[model samples]
Target: MAAVRFADGDWAEDAEFAAYGAATPALRALDAETAHDVAVAALALGLGPRRRRRDGEALRVEALGTTFSNPIGLAAGFDKDARAFEALLRVGFGFVEIGSVTPKPQPGNPKPRAFRLREHGAVINRYGFNSQGHESARTRLARRRDAVAAEGDDATAEPRGVLGVNLGKNKLTPEDNAADDYVLGVENIGEFGDYIVVNISSPNTPGLRNLQGRKHLSGLLRKVLDARDKNPGTAKTPVLVKIAPDLTDAALRDIASVVKSEKVDGVIVSNTTIARPDAIKAHAHGDEAGGLSGKPLMEPSTKVLHDLYKLTGGKITLVGCGGIASGEDAYAKIRAGASLVQLYTAFAFEGPPLIPRIKRELEECLARDGFKSVQDAIGAAHRK
Candidate 1:
């Protein structure tokens, strides 16, 4: 068992966080996916860490018409079925995004699709949107809402964060008619989330990234936005799009154009990269067929975010993702124009302590740069 020492600002002070640290070695003994399953199960049982300290004003962010206590969020794919979002939110994520959920349940690709590149601090996953589908997630969301309602004061009873529902199509859905899947997602679980993400970027899903093309993207967003508008319950919910990191300059520009033209709420700067860096290629699973995420992606993904930020003229909210394992990385994303940031690969590797570490380090960065808050630092690089 790992000794849980109480350092002044370490996450170990939290019993739940310390429990995660103590379990790390054992969890690491299991296969990557199995460990993920166990972690999710544990979180669902309300075993995840809870915040004992309030976020400093420097970490607060106002975006997508809502106020986030902090600017860091857990990206989608961590809780794909929404089984543990409440617990996850309690774990100190400014927000928790669950699902890459399909309209119907899917077993996803064959097993052994998730790989850890420990030496490189990365993961390659081809989960292929394995999901329990819309209904399952909606049921959980409904239950959470009901619980909050039962408490009578949602402001105090609910967790302090946002919930983003990431929507994806079933594998069998054809490319041309993909909008139907996203529209259904909005009509079904849209009202349950603070925001919705149209996840057209997961490389594991066949031809899904093709939707990023300008021609297809405009039509898709139009339909999805229409559904959002028509849904009485979710009419005011913000909708963001998740895009891949592997895009040419022209493609990036085209996506920026589409996003602005369609009036999309925001864009998650990237999902994951399909490229295998030479440094990681020698790893057994480095050449695996899937989206690559973690440290290796920081440079290219941030470059994409910078480009997109310039392309959009900083008009739309951008959620920076991919390769964020430290405060400096998150700060870079923020300076490049991300109003908010998220992570999964790093969290998978470091477990619960990472959340506070990053946030604390981020606050340090903000202070070092002489910025008062995350908002002041956003797009700061562009000013230079």
Candidate 2:
């Protein structure tokens, strides 16, 4: 097979496109709806640079009972249907979490639902968990896994990386029956995922974040754990809860206690934020109605990671998201107690090249900080 060739300056080009592409009048002739279709087409064609591989800087860490080749992961919402898994893995993610998939396919919110805030290097998306749904994802993943297994190579020969599935409640599913939706999602796709993330924090879903409350969280986790326990396998799959960054410290502590008592595998420190920082206040899309994610979210999400680390006393695993654009940002999350880190908006702005850039930067940061490995850097910032 011929090797894929990613365009030169693709990362910078993506940034430029987000900044000025729409202003070209001819391009602006295409509305947001058409623009998205074009972007998806470009991604499907693999339009970015080949990831830079660093053998000496490779990172190994164990979390949720699975070992990851590196600490960086492609956060959910990037490939909502698992469409880009092979390409994404090649781009240097140690793990890839696909979807906030609903039990059934849905068109999601109306057009113009995704807004780019170029000034802040952020995106505001109210996609309402739009997806091709669990069955499609499950079918694709099973095929991929089987193909990998049939290659008959050692673990290293296979992708040998983690795949996480993020599940969400369908729009029509009432909050009262949310657990049923989540359970169905797990039953369908859990077998394919190395781990599963229960995503109840997307601002696009009405009354979703309310599930973060102790009563609902405990009840939901209990059922999901029970399902995992009953699966016909020797190993138990880890279940993680993804939380919003807007939670107060008191709320975070309450959730941490529940996570501990319920034996939840980990917590993704944030989804996205409703709070807009002053730095990006002048941007054109500043008033967009959706969760904001990008550079502005770095400090806030890292703080949340640190607080959760302190609250859980390092017992619960944490996956940090929000504003992680480069290796320094990723290393900061590691030191703040993130066992793994993820990004979405950064990818949207920087393209596939950002993946290797971050890994390279992280290795340099770890060495500069006198840490022998990525794991050694975990919680270093909070310790200070």
Candidate 3:
């Protein structure tokens, strides 16, 4: 087989493209948060690897009433405060999910909150939904909305790429009132986003995962969906709830039930895990007090995603995330029943050049499997 090359040359072998591949090592040497900020700034300046955007029917998938250029999306956390989503779109992601934004700005947990398990290609982050709050994020998103609105003569032109706002509760907010924060979030930012995500799965947030309980989840989704509907001028935004990868099958069943009953539009099958693998246990930062993301999470997260598809009988829209390191991984998620897939840890580790590579590999995977469209492959694993 010929050696696959991402850019004009094999980036792994080319010194000219080394800067992109080197971002991981350079980032690992700094405080993880600081390194993240630097990357975000670079993205804003469009200093990362660049590529021509690709669009066509083959790469398109319809879900949430939107046509995604590809099934791969830039997951939440990278653009946590709604900064740099536009730049990300230009990098060729089919969609970009920003924020785990709260009602007010939060400092999050103390420093050393994020760590890289380089040997394992994994990461741990206990950032506690640190955000610039609803108003700050909404302001930036509104500006984006306005800028796009003014871009051409067609004031009502279709959105170029899908945007999802991941909404979370403030750290100090009592679990009893968690629904209020999400309700306010949908009303305030829902209009600006093509979709909204109800995030209640981060291990970093105390008591937040409790919202995943049947009683709490049902109530929360009801209130949040109601808020999404109340937004004026804009159509009802597709609402999704992200769950932790550590959840039990019983709990997943409950979530599928609540999501169906409440009419939630989609589900991001799994978030980072609070668990660690025995294989990576000896690595430094292995026992860090945060959610673990990347390669080690692949099996568990995909299992959850697959089970969620079966539990929901493939009726629920699903977005598979966590441990996606290649196009094959993304394709696996699709076959497991994900209408879409997202990546963040892999993006941080692999850089912008990784995006096009994954897309190309995904298309190849579909063709090899004799699938005419990516959408046709969704849930094929569960056909038996």
Candidate 4:
């Protein structure tokens, strides 16, 4: 089979596209969950794509106390258990956030819970925070850290971009006790992440979204932040919240108020939507019970990001995620107020070639708008 070729030009590593192209057919033949597992396993073995080009200066972003060579990050849910993070970073993501990890291991929902909406460039997943637990993930990260320390370069080596640890509650955990799970995440695995995400918006988890309620969210953030403060290794780690896209205007306002009042470091807008659009409802398994992400998510999620940006007056850092399939889509998120952006479904569908293409297109968009850097473009739409 011929390798997939980029329309614009051949800038990405040829071997990367060749490997993905050869593997795509076989991967697609398997169930979505199994395919993802196979891909992650391949990546974990260091067989993933290698980015042959460096990010241009136009895409650089300085946020969360470090410099992201580019603003595109691999969102959580892709590497739920922390496996393959290093390989993913090497694939050209400016950062990689792994997990929605729980204090204990979970089997997640039953089989066949992940579906690909190919016609819509989307995915529906009810993975329900399937994780091998904090201990498993902690051990993986610890080994990597130890390896670096052994090299005597731990103190001086530039970070391999930013790594974020996303935390979630176990399905069996009651709503009232959810805070304990998150605090446990910080205490156990927080030191490994450059930032921490308290995920309260996954639709698959029963009653998990309820934590987004102002009353509950406020208490949760405070305890999580306190855990960060008390943990010597994580004292300065930035803590963020990931919310759902289906929130009401009032709910967004409440969340904004709570976030500002508590001085949370950032907000990822959003997780996935339970609301099915007409386009999605027409697809096979469109009615499947789970959170919806991908193309249909682009607009609404950015709208929520825009609303939250306005509500918070842009004080809190915001990560734009949902349906970013191209550089134009990513730029839209930045203008809507995301300091950085992430993508998962699109990457899964198109593979590694999409990464360089996005950065290339984003550079064109920035140049077209006369913006010198990603920071200058962020919230530019709001100003106008």
TM-score of structure candidate 1: 0.95
Off by over 4 Å in 4: 1-12, 152-159
lDDT by residue (1-384, candidate 4, tens digit) is 232334333444766566675676678888898999999988888776666566788888999988898999999999988988988888789999999899999999998899999989999999888899999999999998897677775645445778999999999989999999999999999999999999999999999999999879999999999999999999999999999999999999999999999999999998999999998999988999999999999999999999999999989999999999999999999999999999999999887878888999999999998999999999988896
Please identify which of the two predictions, 1 or 2, would achieve the higher TM-score against the true structure: 1
Instruction: List the pairs of residues colliding in candidate 3.
Output: none
Rank by TM-score, highest first.
1, 4, 3, 2
Pairs of residues clashing in candidate 1? none
lDDT accuracy of residue 40 in candidate 2: 52
lDDT of 3 at 1: 17
Off by over 4 Å in 1: 1-16, 154-159
Best by TM-score: 1
Q: Estimate each model's TM-score.
A: 0.95, 0.89, 0.92, 0.95
**How well does model 2 score by local distance difference test?**
0.80
- Worst lDDT run of 10 residues, candidate 3, spans 1-10
State the lDDT at 255 in candidate 1: 93
lDDT tens per residue, model 1, 124-204: 999999999998888899999998777675555434689999999999999999999999999999999999999999999
Which rank order by lDDT, best down to worst? 1, 4, 3, 2
lDDT against the true structure, per candidate, is 0.91, 0.80, 0.84, 0.90
Candidate 2 structure quality by residue, lDDT tens digits, 1-48: 333343556474345333432333333346544555555555556543
